[model samples]
Target: MRHTDLFYLLALQKVEGVGEINAKKLLSHFGTAEAIFAEKSHKLKKIDRIGSLTVERLKDKSVFEKAEAELRFIEKAHIRAIAFTDKDYPEKLRHCPDSPIVLFSNGNIDLTNRRIISIVGTREITAYGRDFCKDLIATLAPLDPVIVSGFAYGVDITAHLAAIENNLQTVAILAHGLNQIYPKMHKKYMSQVMENGGFMTEFWSSSNPIREQFLQRNRIVAGISEATIVIESAEKGGSLVTASMANDYNRDVFAVPGRISDKYSQGCNNLIKTQKANMLTSAADLVYMLNWDLQQPIKPVQKQLFITLEPDEQKVYDFLNSHGKELLDIIALECSVPVFRLSGILLNMELKGVIRPLPGKLFEVI
Candidate 1:
């Protein structure tokens, strides 16, 4: 976007009561932010929901001074202000009604035709959640999905690091300005993150990471991806808030189940029990549920000569080889393997290039 256009948008953002939804309505009517400011007060009020008080606020020119300062900071910092309507903006987030008018991004983020998923959970991650989170990213690495998460402690940082280890792009959505990094301890990861994927925020350079901003940031985390996964959470936390926002956006939400006795599992259990999210057991569940296999046609995986498989893996391979393509449940039933254990077995077989998963929860020998 041109500096002029961005200036007006930034100024519009400063106008009192002009939120994303209302700003969208005004922009839709006037066609441009500059036009909205140039229009008469009576004419502005004529537009639905643009009350007299809002028009009066728009007349305040102080917002222009703030916008100019922000613009200078953006240019100096080499930040990219991605307008909602820009082709380069995230397609999924652009469709959201409450998405920011302009997103400030500092990184090599290229969302074009990429499968994006957000993984969020409690800051106090447990051994179970940590292992599951890392394994899930490693398993899904074949598909090359971009991982999105808050750059916080525990699950957030873990997901980001796991993606980096797997050579995948990972985005860190910040609650505060890109001018500073929160937690201070995470400063060391900033350079690595910027090189690998980078940081994004709707907040300006003047903003700080306050309590309310975190709540607002959750919506972007939920809205920016095709799906949101809650690895673990207590009965109440930011991850659940993100999941709720994802549900409201009509996007896919998944939660990893834990034992009822576990405190961290309560949020995920409630989400599943309430039917707000699908139960995610493994990477296969997400792949199958999202039908990612269908997005790109699966290439035939040629089985290598003299490939050794575990006894259980051999059983699955033999069953799939004879049955052509079969559902996971059927293979488990025929091979006498529990579904839980069979998922890992099938994943191993896939990694060995002996078999591949098909759409609709089916697998076949390659």
Candidate 2:
């Protein structure tokens, strides 16, 4: 975006009662912020929902001074001001009605034709959650999906590290400005994160990581990705908020199921039970749900040749092997197993690579 246009856009944000929705409305009607300011008061007031009070605020010349200062700061800091109309702006987020008018980003961030997924969870991550996160990332590494997170502790940091370790681009959506890192301790990982992906935020350079800012940041985390995964959360937490936002955005959401009594698992279990999220047990679940195709050839599963299978798994495998290719129901009936139980058996067999699951629950021996 041109500096002069950005200056006016920044000034538009300073106007009281002008938020993302209203700002967008004003921009859409007037074409540019400059035009909005240049228009007569009566014409401006003619816009739907643009009250006389807001028009009066728009006439406040002090906003230009603040916009100039912010522009100078952005130039000095070398931040990229991604306008909502920019071609480089995240496509998924651009469709959101409440997306920020401008996003401040830094480092080697790229979203061109990338598969993006957000991982969010409780700050107090448990051992199970950590292992699941790492294993999930490692498994998904083959498909090379971009990971998005809040860059906070526990599940957020864990997801970032896993993505970094797998050489996947990981974007950290900040609650504060690019001028500072929150929690202070995460400063150590800044270099690695920037090298792999980068940081992004809608806040200005002067904003701080306050409570409301973090809550506001959740929307970006949810909207930026095609899907959001809740690794673990309490019955109530920010991760749940992100999950809810993802659902509201009409994006797919997946939750890792944990023991019913486990504290962190309560949120995920509730999401699944309430049909707010799908039960996510492995990377294959995400891959299948998102319909992501592997770019590289899948390495032949040699382990299946020597791998052992339990009785139920062996029974299902044998039935599928004899039947050549069969639907899940047929395999279940032939094996004398219920459909619910057979689903788990087939999933295990698929993971073991002894059997391959086809579309419509059809399975055949590999």
Model 1 clash pairs? none
lDDT by residue (tens digit), candidate 1, 59-90: 99999999999999999999999999899999
Q: Write the per-residue lDDT of candidate 2 for residues 133-243, one digit (tens) a residue.
A: 988887777667899999999999999999999999999999999999987999999999999999999998889999999999999999999999999999999999999
What's each prediction's TM-score? 0.90, 0.85
Global fold similarity of model 1 (TM-score)? 0.90
Choose the strongest candidate by TM-score: 1
In terms of lDDT, the poorest run of 10 residues in model 2 is 293-302
Root-mean-square deviation per candidate: 3.0, 5.4
Q: Which stretches of model 1 miss by more than 4 angstroms?
A: 297-345, 348-366
Worst ten-residue run, lDDT, model 1? 293-302
